[model samples]
Target: MAGVLLSAAVACVLLAGAASASSSSPRVFTVGGVERGWRQPAPGEETYNHWATKNRFHVGDFLHFRYDKNDSVLVVTRDDYKRCGADRPVLRLEGGEARFRLERSGFLYFISGSPGHCDAGQRFTLRVMAQRDNGAASPTEAPAMSPGGSFNSTPGSGSGSTRMPPRGNAGDGKTSGAAPFGAYHAVGAALGVGAALLAFAPPLPATISDPPSTAASFPAASPMASRLRLGQPNPNPGLSPSPGERKGEEGEARKPEPRREVTDLGGGSEVVHIPRFMSRETAWEMFEHLDKRIPWTRPTIRVFGRSVVQPRDTCYVADKGLTDLRYSGHQPHAHSWDDFPVLKDILKEVHEALPGSHFNSLLLNRYKGGSDYVSWHADDEPLYGPTPEIASVTFGCEREFLLRKKPTNTKSQAAGESGETARKRLKASAPQQHSFLLKHGSLLVMRGYTQRDWQHAVPKRARAASTRINLTFRRVLP
Candidate 1:
């Protein structure tokens, strides 16, 4: 009887050791690896879907994310995940590193919280399965330890912390480890539970982008809108209310000064210039935003049979349903127009200010300094049907806009009066020339026969000049 009992105890011990060996240790996946820095999956690389599909996640396994402070990770619902809704995240993870342990046996969604990043295919769905049975493995295994040696929560531990150490490459071997059962229980319970609650149940998501522009804050019956109704110019152009003018009866606030528009060229050719069309603050904001966000390019152009780089940088942002624009022997592919909030707001203001003018595309030009310039040319492309109306908005430093009337063709004198006579007449006629100083925050509208009858250019400045950004909004017919 003593021998049998001893044998039974040994058998139990062997069985427990076998179960422990069979239980798998949790694996760690370095988000985007160390080189990629948790950004959108690169070309030819394994996408989030591809990566997720290849791995089988268990309830106890953790998904680690490592990225820059500017980027973020978001847990969202299936519907929100499909739509790439950055504004309605179920959980938001900031900081350099984050770890989310699979607590339930179901699908979990995640995406980049940055604007437009999610739409760029930076999201993934994870389906986790229940843990397998093992004799040595208990349902109550101790929580995993982070790289910093701190205890991280296990399923139902309620520690709720998402913080983790900075990302390190998996090849280093130091990031892999298995936790002993029932260890770190005291440390795990002490770590607060607020973060865990938020991780499971987040507040209503807020807008991921900046607030609306000042114009959007005004009421429908605002005095500014009433004073600057369509087709009417501000009584006093570029001048604000004086202290005396600001005072009203019984201390009531005075009406804001109206904006003015100066008609540079009238009659057959329409050219209207509105000085300070945008506020200084708004203009600076736009300038900085565009300078940083726009993907500027210096395309190559055919010059006298040899290709040469363009003098200035340019970008084409087009609306939906329009083909890419190619002009001046240069083919620049159009980038899908992203309705950037600020630019959209600015477009609304411009559309409201200009009556009967509709713009569907914008051709942006960046003049880095006095050295960058565009030679005389007319935007008389066939794509822009005859009598095309163009709205040009200027930001940054001031620059000169030169316009000259197209030379008229003289009737052949005496059938064969030596081509010199026609040339002489063309030189003598000398189409009238005009130059306007396009100040910052100004809008210039050119309509009617402007493209057909006149040529415009931003000539190189003789003296030093700061950077300038010009947006020429136009309609491109199919």
Candidate 2:
């Protein structure tokens, strides 16, 4: 049944080329890794299923893959062909390299031939569009590549194995009218990422990959498993009662305790502000765990108008990792959360501490050495609503926390309310001030009125500091 579905899918895609066209260069795809066999479907083996881009592909285009037949087979087909017994032939190739002319616009998928190979980890998709490209020649040969050549090293990075067709190869050497999709990894290599494979295609099913060292304690099956994978710093230092907590300016709701708070400096204007909220001891332990477990590439982020590199050790603190608090934008890699039990426990405490608070996602930022800081910004994602609650926990190093108001206009839209009435309302955004030091094992919750009115940041200090680790829990909408 699966074989028939695949065969039909291939036919439809190959025939759909006459109508629309592509706008990018013909892409040369490659695959390699643990699943060495690339061709020849093994008994009961399933095909790979995933897309190379968010958009579809058109005709006169080619998807060339250089892979091992013994490892897996790359199949290209239409979306409707995935049914158990559907007759389809998404392009199939094995051993060495093979090219398929996707002459249609629809879904394309691939699978391995080895026994249970596809079920283990071997499938991907490419949505083929139904447009024709100006007559283009396929490349004469493939390029020299490496084992990890397909992985995108940059954050929000694209795949690297796709070779742009040579000049004059496709329409002006580019696919016109086609949207750019990020690079994709081939079958064998995709399996090599070591993530647990799903027999079917649902990603959030019952099973999940084993958490890496730093995040090892939680059950791998839970959705929160993915959230602990990321985090960031102390942007808002103080906590006050959210609107729901408070009444209309009369007898207000009880405010959060300001046990350890930091103060904002010289603030009177509205701008997105983030705070550096944590103590020194806490920062070290987090790094110690990360350094011991996951592999991290030393990277820097722009914060407080300065480009600072997060040092892997204490020495580089003087050179980078320190900056002012005015401008902050930090981007760090996702941690392999396999061992950090504290995170799971901390989250549970947060939920119980503040029942109404909610967060579905998390971003992790590591300050490997002294001087790492994240600037101010409001946590106003539309999906989380006007008054979202953000729980930021800090580990390692002690840094300053500053909170300021966002510009009235930006604040208004983000707060999801308007005018003085909005201001008077005790939502997550309001002119509230507070700051606290996040020591080792410390957790802070930012709820209500905060995202609407205030912006927080963690400015870099010239002090001889240590490393810091911060995690911000959030809920992002699809």
lDDT string, candidate 1, 1-478, tens digits: 5455444444443443343333334445555555665676542334465456445565455566777668888887666876778786656777657666554345567889888776655677665554432322232332345544332433433223343333322345333123223322322332223223334443423212211111000012233543344212443322333453454454433334436555545557878788878755346546755675677898999877888888889988788878667776887767655535445556776897787777888888999999899888899988899989898899998999988987665554424665777678656777878888888889888888899989999999967368999998999998
Write down the TM-score of every candidate.
Answer: 0.46, 0.31
Candidate 2 lDDT by residue in tens digits, 360-398: 455566665546565567766565667666666666665
Query: For this target, which candidate reaches the highest lDDT against the unseen true structure?
Result: 1
| Candidate 1 lDDT trough over 10 residues, lowest sum | 210-219
State the displacement of the C-alpha of residue 31, model 1, in Å, after optimal TM-score superposition: 31
What C-alpha lDDT do the candidate models reach, one value each?
0.62, 0.41
> How does residue 205 of candidate 2 score in lDDT?
24
Candidate 2 local distance difference test against the native: 0.41
Model 1 / residue 76 / CA error / Å: 37
